[model samples]
Target: MSYTVNCSILLTDLPLLERPAAAKAAGFDAVEFWWPFAGSVPGDRDVDAFVGALRDAGVQLTGLNFNAGNMPGGDRGLVSWPARSQEFLDNLDVVAAIGERTGCRAFNALYGNRQDGCTPEEQDELGVQNLVRAGRAVQRIGGTVLLEPVSGADAYPLKTARDALGVIAQVRQNGADNIRLLADFYHLAVNGDDVAAVIENHTAEFGHIQIADAPGRNEPGTGELPLQQWISRSRQLGYSGHVGLEYRASQEDPFAWIAAWAHV
Candidate 1:
C-alpha cells in the first residue's frame, strides 16, 4: 500500500508547482517527479518554489529523476553523453540538495540515447563511470541510484530489466554498490519482458517500481495489463518500496481510472 503519485504526469491541468497540492488533494501522501525545472541547475528561486510546494502539499518525496535534458524535445538523459558529462555531474549537486531537504533517497538516472558519433561501447563505458559517481554521491544520504529501462525510444538503450541490471553490474563491479534497478513494469511489458519472471527472479534488486497499464500507458483497467496482480506479486515477494504512478492520463482526471487507488 506504499504508493506515490507521479505529479509530473498525473496532474497536468495544473501548473508545474501546483501539481503537488493537487496530488495531495487526490489522497496520496507521497509523491515523485521527473525533473521539474527546465534547466539542470535551476535558479535559487525556482528551487525554493519547488521545495516549498512539496512542503505546502504535505507530501513526502519518494523518488526523483536527475535532470534529463529536454525531455519534451526527446533527450532521455545525459549520464552517458560524453559532451554533457560535466552537466550531468553538476546536476547531481542539485539533486542531492533536494534530497537533503525532502528526505528522498531514490533517484532515477535515465541513460541517454545513442549518440550520432559515439560508438555504443564508448557510451556504455562512460555510462558506468557516471553511474558510479552518482551512486557514490547519493550514498552519503543513505540513498540509492535507480537505473530504469525505458520503452518507445529506439535509440535509448536499457530496454529491459536484464539490460539495466547489466549496466548496474558494471557499476557494482566498479565499487558503487548503491546502484540498483528501477523496474518500470509498463516499459518492461512493452519491450516484451516477462513481468512475472522479472519479479520472481530479481525482486531483491529493485530499488523502486513504477507502473502504467501499457498499450496506451494509461491507468489500470484502461489497458490490458494485469497491474494489481503484478503489484501484489511484487509486494508478496518482499519489494517494500513505493510504486510510482508514472503514466499519462487518458482523461481529465487520471486518478478516476483507479478510483482513488481503490481499484489499483
Candidate 2:
C-alpha cells in the first residue's frame, strides 16, 4: 500500500529542489516527477543534484517520466515525432542512467501529439519503435515503460485504458514484455470511460495506478470521484503497484486528503 506524491504537480508553490523535502514533510515517503528538467536530456550534473535532493529528503523515487517535449506548452512526447526520433532514442541512455541511480522502476512515455504532416499510423509506428527500444533500455535496470491516457489531448491518441493497452501489446509483440499501462483514474474519468470497469478488468495489466479527483484535478475530498474506493478495488483485483497522488493541492496542508488512503 505505497502512496507516492507527484512532485511535478503537487508542489507548484515550492522551488523544484525543495519539493521532495516538502512532500516528505507532508508524509509522503515516495515521490514521482515528470522529468524535473525542462529538456529531455539534461546534463549529468543537473541530474545528480536532483537525485541528491530526493535522497536528502529520504523519499523513494517511485515513478518517473521520460523527457516529454514541452509538456506545459502542449507537446506530449518526442518519440513519435519523425524529426525527433533520434533525439528520443538518444535520451534513453539518460533515462536508464537516472533509473539506475534512483532505483525507480517505472517510466511513463507519453505518445506525442499528431503532427501536421505525419499521419496517425506513421506516428504510431515511430512511437512504438522508439518505445520498444526504450523498454529494452529500462529493462536493463529492471524497469517497466508505462503508457498513459491523456484527457483533452486532441493530438494525443491514447485516451483510455484500452488504448494504452493496445500500444503495450504492440510493444510487447516487438519483444519488449516490460511494457505496461499506467491506469490514471483522473484521465480515465475525464475521458468519460467507466473507471470502475477499467479497474475490474485491467488491474492485472496495470504496472502503475495514479489518482486525482476528476473535473478539477484537485485533492480527493474536493472532487466527486471515489478515488479511495477505486484504489482499494484495484488492489483487490491484483494490481500491486504504487498509487501516485498526481494531483494539485487546493488546501494549505497539501496532505490533508491522506486520510482517504487508509479509509479506502
Candidate 3:
C-alpha cells in the first residue's frame, strides 16, 4: 500500500516548487493538489513549472481536483442548469489537457450545489448527462474522472458514497466508461458510513481515495477514526492504488504527522 500526500497541506507559505520537494523529503513518492492550475497562487507559477518541480523532486503527480464552480452568483454546475453544460465541458477539456501534460491520470469532478429550483430526479439526470460528456472528454486525454461526494454540510448535492455510486451507475448505463468514484475518509466519517465497506463494495468504480480523520478534518492520528484498520482493510479489498493524505495538521509542521505514519 503506497501513499501520496496532498500538496495543499504543505502549500501554505511555500512556493509551488518547494511543496513537492517538501512532500518528497517527507517520504512521499507522489502528491495531489486541489486546484494548483487555477493561476491564483500569486507570481507567474504555471502548470508546466509545477510539473517540472515534481519531476525534479522525483515525485509523481497523482491527482488534480477540478473547480466546483460554486461561486457567489455563478452557475454552480451542469446538474441543475442546462445552459452551463458547454462551459462545464470546455472547463473539463482544459483541465484534462493539463492533467495529461502533468502525468496525472485521476481528476476529481465536483458535483456542485443542489439549488431549490431543480427537483431531485431532475438533478440526478442532469448530473449524469454532464458526467457522460465530461467522461468522454477525459477518456480522450487518457485520464479518469472520479466523482467526489461532498458531505451535505460541505456541499449541496451528492452527499454520500451511495449517491455517488448511483451517478456512476447512471453514467455506465449511458455507455460512458471514463467516470469513476473517489472515496474520501473524512467525508465518509462525517456522513457516518463505514469507509472500508464502501471501498470494498465499490472497488470497481473507485479510482482514488483521500483520507483525514473525522470531526476535526485533521491528520488521521489526531481524530478518533482508526486509520490503520482502514488501510489494512483496503489492502484486503485489493486496492493497489495510492491512498492520498489529504488532511490538515493540527501543529505547524506537516512532517510531524508524516513521521508518525512510519509505524503504519
Residues 1-264, candidate 3, lDDT per residue (tens digit)?
Answer: 288888866555787678899888777789987666442232334666877888888888889766545443443344435545555665776677767777888988777676566676776778888788777877877888888866644435677889888888889899788877898878877887777688678766668878887778887778788777776677677767888888777777655665656443
Name the weakest run of 10 consecutive residues (lDDT summed) in model 3. Answer: 36-45
Better of 1 and 3 by TM-score: 1
Residue 73 lDDT (model 3):
40
What TM-score, over all chains together, does every model reach?
A: 0.97, 0.97, 0.85
Query: Candidate 2: where is the Cα deviation over 4 Å?
Result: 260-264
* Angstrom error at residue 246, model 2: 0.8
What is the lDDT of every predicted structure here? 0.90, 0.87, 0.73
* Position 33, candidate 3: lDDT: 78
Candidate 2 Cα lDDT to native: 0.87
Per residue, candidate 1 scores C-alpha lDDT tens digits across 135-174 of 9888889999999999989999999999999999999999
Candidate 1 wrongly placed segments (more than 4 Å): 260-264
Worst 10 residues of 2 by lDDT: 255-264
Q: Cα miss at 124, model 3 (Å)? A: 2.4
Q: Give candidate 3 regions above 4 Å deviation.
A: 39-45, 70-84, 152-155, 258-264
